[model samples]
Target: MQDAAEPPPLRSRRDLVKELSLGMVAFGADARNLTSQGNLTPAQTRRLLPAGLVAAIGGELVASMAYLAMGRWAYASAALVRQLVEVEYLAWAVTNDPDDAWEWLKSDRQTRLQRWQPGKIRQRSDGRFPNSDYHAHCEAGGHPVPEPAMNILDHRDQWVELSLYEAAVHGTATWHYLVQAVGDAPVTAAERHHRLIDEAHNVWRRTETLDRGFLSPANGSDA
Candidate 1:
């Protein structure tokens, strides 16, 4: 049973902006540091980071816009998945079910999200969503959502989380490239990004309880 004291789901654009902003800032700072270690001058490093940061920002913006479209169209299944997946992504740091994400992306983007709804739509005045209500609404329709790492299990009876892993992988890869570009074998940028990725990985592992008693995964501890 869920505690009545549980806070409502953050369902506002402002919340999205805040979360995305923090992630972008963290990512952008790392990007800048990596670039600064390269053959490029400070000016080039600055320019490179702004561009890369824009792409990262664009990704978040596009995702938010998609959620907005989902809400407007009352595509409850799609909307809920988008929202939940995003939340889980933020928590876990990797893409959840790349196959599913691909499927959503391949669907008709322009008109598919604006379809109709037949049920009574309830609105939250304070913009808070109770966990029970969210679970009820999101899972009632057999929506093929990816198993959440902290809360759900996958087909192999494994806790499947990906977003944090993806972020860590991205950060690590970028760090390597940046290290190579900067021509520094003992640079701090590489180590810092590596540490960030390690932090993200630790979060993922803890969320899944892999180090506790969970088992049957090669990526996790033998607990």
Candidate 2:
């Protein structure tokens, strides 16, 4: 028996990865079942963009876990950036008129770029950014926005999130490359295992928020 004062042993990294993988698989299945419940009309089918975005997020999460297992932290970080993009896409889908959102999603790069060009993106009176302001948009749409949506849209840590995402995708930060070179050497195996567990928990939390806010029966019907 272990001493009462001692901390419990950490689970293996493989176990952590397996747990995360299983959770994602379950989420994917749930999303599929949710989307397949009833025959959708043509307009409804077009509005399935948020469901597609949720699936995209699941793919990014699985890719992130794969990269982490392969000791490719930078690639994993880049996957995280893609996941954030999916979240933004989901927000855009739920908040706007479905037809307009679908048109924008299917628009060519040049057309999309023209809409998002400098001076075109306006800040609202509530201090929220255009198109991605979940709180404001949800209120306007008479939908209840989830806490995660508000948390992310509040922009309190906007700079930090933006910097990390930019560094991961653009290789702008030296540590991004340096950490990949160093691999997991900076921490003990147990420490690394715990880190993986923490990362998995964060991903699950975000996934739950997305499911509840945009993919549940009540909310998904609107999409």
Candidate 3:
């Protein structure tokens, strides 16, 4: 018999996107089942928080996937900011008194209280404040924190740790991707595509792990 032919190399960008999509679908089904099992009523505001967060995270992942597929790498990174926010919210729910967390969520003033003050504090005209510090909150809860691509908050040289999400949200450094060049070096379309795909895969994997942890029996979910 003739030897079997070698299989073609998998396309990293396409395969990763497909895999991420599948993971989102599975998570959605599991989330729905968990919500149904709880039989949560509108009045059960505390219990509703987890379900709502789960849905929100899933939606954020979908948005990220869409952006990645469309070659909007910066916007895709921006979409992940919500995932990080939701994960921290989940950590709060699992580690603290659910009632207290729920109360904080409801209060605009309380939620706006700044948890981190770096350097000289400047008052905001918009009256917005930074939320909980991501690393501290996750660490306090004994939950795994997703590895940050950049430390935009505490770094001495802000530009040294500029994150894609920050760039996309603020329109700073977005020209790097828009012009297909970084600093003095040119980034080919293929290189940029693969790089963002790898980054997205990492984010998805970490976020999924956090999601499962929140839904695990020890965290109080039936999942």
Candidate 4:
């Protein structure tokens, strides 16, 4: 019998993009097939979660590579990228609400508020976070956790959410501009990176949509 063939070595971000996108597509198909017949087996659920995580990671990597291609010359572009990062971080700060995060992304208002005073989530008269509980809990505790001097949402989950969000925004924005900014780079290199970033972003977007569409309702159904 012939030996199994070896897989090709990945050479660039583009390659990673292709791999990640393909994986997500496959996973989604499987998930749908399984759901249609019956619920996923425990093992399948475990596998799916990891694949979703991987897709999310790929999205961040793609965005980062794009920004890196732009180099220091794209200062305005870079700042915009940074703004994306900040918004993502703030998203986590406010809890993983994409709606709230995207809302802040559209305006500098939240950033300005955050920038001016750390952990300052604007609240309504009822004293609830406009959308989050980050500050409310901290404030209401009888022995209030001394607000960390710097970033307010400093907990591990909060930090990870912030970090992931920043990475996603920076990576996506960078990927979008990489081609224009790095045209001077070798053609093949540019194209590869661009494709990688695009693929990564697409995978992330699809995965997120799937998660929101499927998981949220499923959770509600359980409740």
Top model number, TM-score: 2
TM-score of each: 0.25, 0.36, 0.32, 0.29
Local distance difference test, each candidate: 0.34, 0.36, 0.34, 0.34
Task: Name the TM-score of candidate 2.
Answer: 0.36
Q: Rank order by TM-score, top first?
A: 2, 3, 4, 1
Judged by lDDT against the true structure, how good is candidate 4?
A: 0.34
- List runs of model 4 lying over 4 Å from the truth: 1-154, 184-187, 209-223
Candidate 1, 1-223: lDDT as tens digits: 3334432222222233233334444554655566666865554453344433432543354344334443442222223333332333222211222222223324474422432111111121133223433343244222544442213333212221122222223223333333333232233433454455445444433333223112224423222
Clashing pairs in 4: 63-171, 63-172, 64-171
Badly placed stretches (over 4 Å) of model 2 are 1-38, 69-72, 75-79, 116-223
| Between candidates 3 and 4, the lDDT winner | 4
Cα RMSD for candidate 3?
18.2
For model 1, which pairs clash? 9-129, 38-182, 92-164, 93-163, 93-164, 94-162, 94-163, 94-164, 95-163
Candidate 3 ranges with C-alpha deviation above 4 Å: 1-45, 69-72, 75-86, 89-96, 114-223
Give the best candidate by lDDT.
2
Candidate 1: where are CA atoms >4 Å away? 1-24, 30-171, 184-191, 199-223
